[model samples]
Target: MPDQIADPSDLRGDCAQCFGLCCVALPFARSTDFALDKPAGKPCPNLRGDHRCGIHADLREKGFTGCTVYDCFGAGQKVSQVTFGGQDWRTGTKEHARQMLDVFPVVRQLHELLWYLNEALGLSAARPVHADLRRALERTERLTRQTPQELAALDVAAHRQEVNVLLLRTSELARAGVAGKGGKGGKGGGKDRRGADLIGARLKGADLRGASLRGAYLIGADLTGADLRGADLIGADLRGADLTDADLTGAFFLTQPQLTAARGSAGTKLPESVTRPVHWTAGS
Candidate 1:
């Protein structure tokens, strides 16, 4: 099997092919992320008839920062087009709309796993488990294509657990040989900070090479100029975190959503997998 999937464009959200599912199917409470409360299955007031955000150009100015950070991992278009046969929720029956909404989240979760699996397969160091990752990816893609009823009835949590085991192994294999700056060998010399609560903590200029930061709460934390090469950032909450000038050159499992939610600058070196957030400043 090839080390990487042929194409990963399907793993990304494409709003043009979607039916505004995220705007309608997801709920949001009034907070710094959102400006108002919205119930599930209801359209956001900013949604236009064409299934585009009316405030797309000014989401941040309009107090919809959360909207800018969220990514459906291509689940929106899958549910909107493939699953529903291009059915528009606005024109569908209330029951149909509800079912679509319910299934959106389920497929979203699966697609997220697909994203991680795809990434894992691309890692040269993870070649030992590449075949398993490929199998998991194919299985996840099959699950995403299931009927809405099957999706709604799917035990996604159980599936996630199964996939996570492979991802954990992949992480171990990928990070095992990344020697830290201080001559520390093997997994960044014991910088295991998995699931740590570092909210609002100052970590500027810290060296976190090959560190395990999976499931860590880094909300509002200052990570400016940190050396994060080879770090595992799966499930890390980086909302409101400062990443100015941070060196994340070889970081793995750092999704676009997490990168977008944090603050950075043009000088912040990032891995090729994720793009630099537009909100990031031009200078360091």
Candidate 2:
């Protein structure tokens, strides 16, 4: 597989292809993430008759910032088009709507795995296990096509665990190539800040090659020009962080949501699964 994936980000989302599933299928409580309280199966008042959010253009200004941060990884369209045969819940039978709600989350998990698997395939250093990655990718894709009944009963956590093992191996192989070589990483290699509280830390230009930052709190950190190639950023909180020229060529499990929340520039090098936010070019 090539380092650059032509359309892997398509797995991210295309709301036009969906049936407003997120607005109706999921529940939200009043909190920092959500401004209103809504129960499951209840449609958001902002949802138009055509299934588009009426406040999409000014979601954050209207206190719907949570909507902007949410990504279903293309599950909405899969459930709306494929699983439900292009049916919209507003017009579908009550039982059909119920089934659609149940199946949507399952598809989301499957698509997320697909995103990670595609990214792992893009790591040239992990070429030795490309065959295994291909097989895992096929399995995940197949599961996404299962019927609603099958999905309702699927052990998605177990499936995710299996895929995670391969991803960890892929991350190790890719990060190893940039581990040592100098600076904060020293001669032995990169630093390990896994699950550390790095919020507001001054790590600008730090050598983080091959570092495990899984579950790290990096909110508001200054990481400009950092070398983060092949780092494990599975659950790192990047809201308000600066990555002006950081190199993240092979970082594992770094989602588009994380990047959109951070500050970066055209100089920032990213892996295949992430897309640079349009606002990043506004010279903030």
Winning model by lDDT: 1
Tell me the tens digit of each residue's lDDT in model 2 across 15-131: 999999999989989876678999988999999999999989988788776788789988898888988889888898889889999888889989988888887787777898888
lDDT agreement with native, every candidate = 0.89, 0.82
Which candidate achieves the best TM-score against the true structure?
1
* Model 2 misplacement above 4 A: 2-10, 180-189
lDDT of 1 by residue, 1-284 (tens): 26777357887899999998999889999999999999997899999999999989999999999999999999999999999999988898988889999999999999999889988988898999988998998899999989989999999999999999999998888888664654544443337788999999899998888888899999999999998898899999999899999999989999999999999998899998899888888653
Error of 2 at 150 (Å): 0.5
How far in Å is the alpha carbon of 278 misplaced in model 1?
A: 1.1
Cα RMSD to the true fold for all candidates: 1.9, 2.9
- Residue 137 shift from truth in candidate 2, angstroms: 0.8
